[model samples]
Target: MSSESTVLIFGGCGFVGFHLVRHFVKTSTFTSVAVVSRSAANHDNHVDGATYHSGDLTDHDSIEQLLLKIKPTIIIHAASPSPVTGTPNEYEHVTIQGTKNLLKIAKRSKDVRALIYISSSALAKGPEHVNLDENHPLANTDPKSSAYARTKALADLMVLEANNPFPFSEPSVKETSWEGHLLTASLRFPIVYGTHDPTTIPGCLSALQKGQIAFQLGSGKNLWDFCSIENVCAAHSLLVQALLNPKRSPGAAKVDGEAFNIHDGSPHLFWEFARTVWKFAGHRPKNDKVTSLPAWFVLALASFLEWGYWIVTLRTKRPYNLGRQQVEYACFTHTYSIAKAKERLEFTPKQDFEGGLKEAVTWSLKQDHWDEKLKHVTLTN
Candidate 1:
């Protein structure tokens, strides 16, 4: 980054966003770093050395003013509703319209030379996704998909399209800082987990504490990619470096107006992830056994349970533990190729899988003050 380089992150207090804040703060590469969060005062997980601001993404007036005041050289948008618990309206405001506002304002915030979006590769297009890459068509408007997925798919496309400095007028041949175009890119991830993680690792450990580890959702052959937090953060840093050195040729073109899948370059059986978490939690296999349940049968059982629960509990915010989406994730192969990330951003996993898991489990349990005995953990809402 140049002497005027300043990085501003939209969701700086979030799981992924905070990790990025820590990454930049620890590395101290940029001249200044700032983060905008919806609620800045409530973050117990916030990192040091980075300034924090409270602001809503939908409020265009405040966001535009903040951009002008900060004059950031690099901007990373990692803000969005929770994928598991978010509603359709939440997706609309934050993922879709919020992204539109960011792009619209970014066009005028000329100091912003680079924009990186943290996106998810967990789009449910079919029963399985094997080695899918940036070329895979997005199902942003699929009526069958969840609102979170639909809107996220749409926002990622928006980020790529906004790469041009002139969206309304004629396009320029090449978009660079000289041309005043925002060099935009998106990094797609699946199942990110590590230290200070509130979801992935904890969910697995919660299942273990509830004595549900041996229950298989479907055939245990399904596979999914998992990336450590350090790996994901490393990819973001590499992209920042690449975007700053865009004149590096063939590799440089890969940074702008592109989306890249990022992961550990290895895929494991779905339940294998949970089993590994249990191993780190001072547990030994009593037996190599699991109770298998057919996926179709589970889905049928879930549909009936969902209707009855709605009638009984009337829980409008439905988060059925055994819903169709959960079943598919546990029974399908959802793996992606990180070849583009490697070739374009020169990205690779900074932490080894099992080693990283050990570090995560150790840090997470310490936070809970567990005394070598597994304690009860709430797995869901």
Candidate 2:
């Protein structure tokens, strides 16, 4: 990479995006840093080291202009429908359409170097298995599913195939004529939890506050690889910086099209993780009885609530909101192996499950967000 290399990150306002933006901006390696989001959020303005551009991923014109203006060498497309937000179609629009827009932009950006997509491990083939790697097929036939998973799977395919160095079909629209191949890396992340976690933390807290969480979801033995937001950001940065290194990178001849399971390398059961939060928050499990809700019932309830809201509001909004998905997902076991990333990207998670949860709980207390009664819980032990 040249000293003139510019890096542009899409969707830098959301949780994982915020963490990535902070990491890239502070690195001081790039000539300039730019962030493009649907709108300029409060946190966007506060990113001292980067320039923030207001642009929506679904808007082709905005994306074109943003690409033209920034002329980035490294593009990090982290913008998409968050796992907890948007209906099924909305997920398609953001993940698929947003990616198409970015790819179009990348085709135009003559100086572009690498494009790294932060995808989800929720796209894994084995929602029932313990530990999965990149080779596992996606759970394409899961009857009980969320739109988020489906769209991510689609987008991931688009990305991998888009790499010209690979033997995939070329997109009809090439915004700009390309000189060489565009390196694409798909980093699949697991149940990411950390500071600025607008969705996960709040939903969990709401259930606890309402006394709705009685027993662990399922048998509570299903393992999940819960990653820290900071660690996720760190690994991404390492990958980006490595792309600038000629000896390390796959070079122009290589597609650099690879998928790596990104996690903290440790799997924790749903009950085990929940118990940690309860202890830290100074609360006892609301319901001691472990009752099992069949997967069919959970999905049915979720669909009913989702459709009911759509009917009532005349909008495709989920009725139970983000909480419904959390309840359902908590029952399943999901884990991934990050060994590839650790070896290739020189990545190591800085925060483990225990430390990350503790920090998150502390931040919640500072915000006065948690139930006041549980504030005195012995967190240190």
Candidate 3:
């Protein structure tokens, strides 16, 4: 709230966390900003004003010591393994147990005021979640969901349930007279894309370079939600402001122990968005360049590939990317409602779909993978 407040971001060296560090350093009034990562030695994109601490969330003693040393007023939990590539053990250790450790430490830490978690829309289950909201049932109960999703859902529940005004009955510290409770909340982001995105946009560029972007999954009629990196950073700032502001009314009540979906506020057809990005990246799509296939056929192929990869990697630990989840993401129509985020956190998307795509494409053009043959192509018209 004030310049005295210290904000600490876990997983600060990561894609989203890097943007968050820059946002806090450039925009936030908080005096002290620190990022915790497993190893901060060679972090390439370090911000000027923020501090980086080498720590591991799985190491409970290290985290406890770091929290005691820094005494941060706000803790932003953004550290987690990649949803597509991480193993079950990594998810359990870093996402579930690590979050539990943080909750345990924050409950007794007097200076800590708020704990903001970065969650995913994958927590919602079933095809019926076309317009998912906070009340949607979590996928943690579903056995068929990915290990990452289930563990993250469990962590989300822990953070929300730990949001008590009174400290836990069994305090971590007995002699301390400080008795402040921690406020907690979470923001669910959908397919975040921006300059430094290591996932969606890069994967698209790879497909385009390999000439594999010609086929559309199903009819490409599915509308999906995407969150711009800038918008995600803005939502975090707005929620933190609401959580720390005492003068703010009961409207802020919706934020405590609550989860809000943040997106670009515009859902776009899957193929249309893909073609737009391709066009912006200097690849012009022709009528024959793009084709559609039945969703069932593609899903079947994905299942086969998954089975083959699992059998081949019986002894190794390699991960397969093309699977049922990828098929579902390509063909499913799941858009989140950002009305709660807007009303509660006063959050509005700063960049629309085209603008965000333009930024991402501009960045992509400068990368080494940009095709020289279509260098003159533009998103205009």
The model with the greatest lDDT is 3
Task: List runs of model 2 lying over 4 Å from the truth.
Answer: 41-45, 139-144, 165-180, 248-255, 284-300, 307-315, 321-328, 371-381
- How much is 183 displaced in model 2, in angstroms? 0.8
Better of 1 and 2 by lDDT: 1
* TM-score list, all predictions: 0.89, 0.85, 0.90
- Model 3 misplacement above 4 A: 166-180, 248-252, 315-320, 367-381
lDDT of 1 by residue, 52-149 (tens): 88888899999999998888888999998887656567789999999999888887776787799999887536557898988887766467665666
lDDT tens digits by residue: candidate 2, 1-381: 565667888888877887777777787767788888877655533477888888888999878887878888888888887676567777878888989878766865676757889898887654464677787877555654556777788788777776654123444222333435676888898777887777666666655566555544466767778888877877777777665554542333332677877878777777676667655666654435666666667656766777676788776666554235665566677777777787777788765688889888767756645756444443322
Give one digit per residue, the lDDT tens place, for model 3 in 219-266: 788988888898988899889888776555443356788899999898
Q: How does model 3 score by TM-score? A: 0.90
On the 0 to 100 scale, the lDDT of residue 62 in model 3 is 88
Which ten-residue region of model 3 has the weakest summed lDDT?
A: 170-179
